[model samples]
Target: MMDWRTKLLDPTPHARRDYASLATPVYRGSTVLFDDQKAVTDDWRQADNGYSYGLYGTPTALELAARIAGIEDARETFIVPGGQAAIALIYLSYCPAGSHALVPYSAYGPNKAMAEGLMRGLNVEVESYDPLIGAGISDLIRDNTTLIWCESPGSVTMEIQDVPAIVKAAHAREVSVALDNTYAAGVMFDAFAQGVDVSMQALTKFVGGHSDLLLGSVSARDDVAYAKLGPIYQQLGLAVSPDDCSLALRGLQTLAVRLDALEKATLQVARWLAEQSLVDTVLHPALNTCPGHEIWSRDFSGSTSVFSFIFSETVTAEQVVEFINALTIFKIGMSWGGVNSLAVVYPELERPGVDFGGRIVRLNIGLENPDDLVNDLRQSLGSI
Candidate 1:
């Protein structure tokens, strides 16, 4: 009895729908339907209250958040646009305009950048500290100190932090501790069990597995932390794509298998590199030569594929570029945790006192056979 246009806009389902599939449905929408006017409300606590709006997350994103929370044993997890967004969320949530925070010198570069750029502009004082400082972090805490950040087997240099010691020091001062847990994939290390207030990961890496997506997660260890983060998350509107969430779900299915294979192949390559005459230091946490390797052994259940090694002083920075160009299988690029191996030289990489002087190269071992990867490295090193 209505016009065809009216029929086309009908909200009723046209097909019988009792069927189900193992895959998480890719739910995409900007609007959510309410049963009645009384049921409509906007709340970001989708895990507890029913989902209110698409910006908070449809079912797809909620499922990914739930899975990450389960893996980390957290009270809740918030899905964001990328790993950087997760860092911003935690900073904005805990470090107010006038507060002070502590971060390891070896944290993800963007994290330090945020500390100097955005947080500084907002009047927050973020101080970089030694990754191995451990309980000494207590001395750095001031009356206004609110957050302490740890990144184990840190960015390029792979300096592992004494997380439990740092946590104890911060808790005594009634300060919060947050960790960049992306290196561990929320599985290799237990962030919540270590007494961290929040644990964040770049799901783009291990959780997405195939280098096909960009996503991140910020998880709260308890209800107190959850209550602190939720409102800020809503205000920021850090929504993620449902398609990416579906890929992450698929990645989770094979996560354990992929990790097992990656660990074996990576250790093989790292050990081979450690023995090479051209290599000065291999920064794999599983190896004893790395800084804070003892702490990593105590805190981590396993190590993953990405790590770095420094060229012996005998090799010049220019030769590092030549070495990267000579590689056959290990492609020259940045961003790790994928199906393909990667190598990139950090000519300007430095700490407070030590300088790599363009001689450090970071590697992300892929699913390639260990022999082939080792051969690739050998030939490349020979060229240098």
Candidate 2:
């Protein structure tokens, strides 16, 4: 038999038929049958076959997980309710009470919030560090440090972290590394190959390119972490709907193509934004002027469609609202990685000492015409 990776990428008959049916059939069930009592007992122990119970996973979810694992070059994959749950699972799996964790300062808002609010209450020391610390992270490791969390081209800030350097630093101290790879969506970066122990993604964004489903996946480099987390994941009763898994599987089929188009168009728009008098700087990893572009270029194969920019002039909340409301092509929404373009303004809710300036706008480029997006931005900026 051919390698599953080759089979997954190739336009083979099996691959097409997997979803060729007008709609990916949903396998809804809470119980699974076995041939006999002995077989059921064996399955209940998870000693044989690919599945045992609905929460453990079904054929539909398994197929999606296999495809994602193949893409990430990981040993196993676990599908969770959403991205935040995936992150939470990693924390819950490894970080015990009285443990310490290193999290990027500019990571997704929820991630920071979880580390600060929930983990802190649990007696876990979650320290926020600069994402650019890279190899220097060795200095931050403590006896209780158990996990180091990273996010490349961070959510709203779009700061690219030096993943390899940080991974090397963490591994030296026997610390596990987890990356919020939702931004790059595994298209740009390979977390496992970069020495990361586990990789997590919000399939809701890129993998579910249509943005019609909410799903998250955690891919473990080897069985160590998988074996440790699998039981916990099962115990938590975390499971994605078979329909959502099927949708994510279908989205994976065309992810590379959709991401290619979106990334190219996004870079074009970023360049145009950089040239505008209203813009102070374009926060994109692909740009040579970005703070961590060298690391991004060295560690990543490509960039995602999402990026942000800072305005030259500080604009009021009302002005920001007007700018967003004036857009014709870009829709005002929360999450990105959809086929439709999106625009959102990041409010100035910085940490006490962290000054990230005032006017930062994040843009999620879609499969839309670049010229039209540029024109829409021009009009919006003019209105502002």
Candidate 3:
């Protein structure tokens, strides 16, 4: 004579199967049943051993996290809903109320917005430092400065920061360094080897490869930092869809190939853009014209498909819009790293420290033929 609850809580569906497949199976569940009541009391906080709860991680999430952790050379990894969530988690995990944090002037817009808007309301002091500060960042550090945020190859502007120098300076002051390594997709940059304490990235961009799914990961270099951040990660109740995790895992298998293809295709387009009379400067880090090109050349093993260029003074506002609108091959939209090419015009956010005199256009090179992309650009610029 069992109650209705006893029948409803059965875990018999997970029957053993003797089948194997190349792909990681998607595990989706909210409740995790145990053999005995005492087993329910076991520690399920970390994903090292087995399933805890769906919110903590399922096999799908753990597989993706392990893969990202391997590339990042980190002790553990946590998956979040999106890149911004990863950024927020790092900020909140380190900077308590009344603490101070330093953010780069060229950081992702949402990151800066969170710091200025929410973190400020919580009594945390958020300050912006120049991307070129490098080791000189020591001067900006204060007694209560608990965290320092770095975004190499600043979003849209594409200015590479001296990560090692900044990390060294931060470590000396007993401060933690967290980086938005989204542009590199954690593959191009060896964040941990370079002394980054916490490496956070948007898996939506490159790791997902396709623009279909959105995901993010935060990896810690050591046990101490992971221990400090783990509780906060759980408290935030951050969870990713198992379907998205499966897609990300699939995308990772081809990451190296896709990244290499993107690098080659983007450089061709960027170099061609630089030659245009209407183009003022190409902001690709691999190019000598970009700021911190030397640092990029030294630290980064390769480049990505995303970069920005400034239009020459001769180009008019209407002309800029006309050129972007006339492009037949490149789609006018936001977000990169998808198989489809995309472009967007940034009308002077007036981001601090860097200046784009004329209209700035950021191109996300796709898997299209470089010749076709160049032809599209030529026709558009010629029409203007």
**Top-lDDT structure, candidate number:** 1
lDDT of 1 by residue, 115-160 (tens): 9999999999999999999899999999999999999978999999
Name the candidate, 2 or 3, with the larger TM-score value.
3
**Considering lDDT, which of the candidate structures 2 and 3 is the better prediction for this target?**
3
How well does candidate 2 match the true structure in TM-score terms? 0.91
RMSD of 3: 2.1
User: In model 3, how large is the Cα lDDT of residue 344?
Assistant: 85
- Segments in model 3 whose C-alpha atoms lie over 4 Å from true places: 1-10, 14-16, 42-44, 353-358
Stretches off by above 4 angstroms in model 2 are: 1-25, 42-48, 314-317, 351-357
Which scores greater on TM-score, model 1 or model 2?
A: 1
Question: For every model shown, what is its TM-score relative to the native structure?
Answer: 0.99, 0.91, 0.95
Residue clash pairs of candidate 1: 347-358
Superposing all C-alpha atoms, what RMSD in Å does each candidate have to the true structure? 0.8, 7.7, 2.1
Ranking by lDDT: 1, 3, 2
Off by over 4 Å in 1: none
Q: How many residue pairs clash in each candidate?
A: 1, 0, 0
For 1-384, candidate 3 gives per-residue lDDT tens digits of 988899788667675787799999999888877767766743335576566577888888988999999998999999999999999899989999999999888889999999999899999999998898999999999999999999999988878999999999999999999999999999788999999999999999999989999899999999888887788888889988999999999999999999999999999999999998899999999999898999999999999989999898888767788889999999998898889898888876567654554389999999999999999999999898
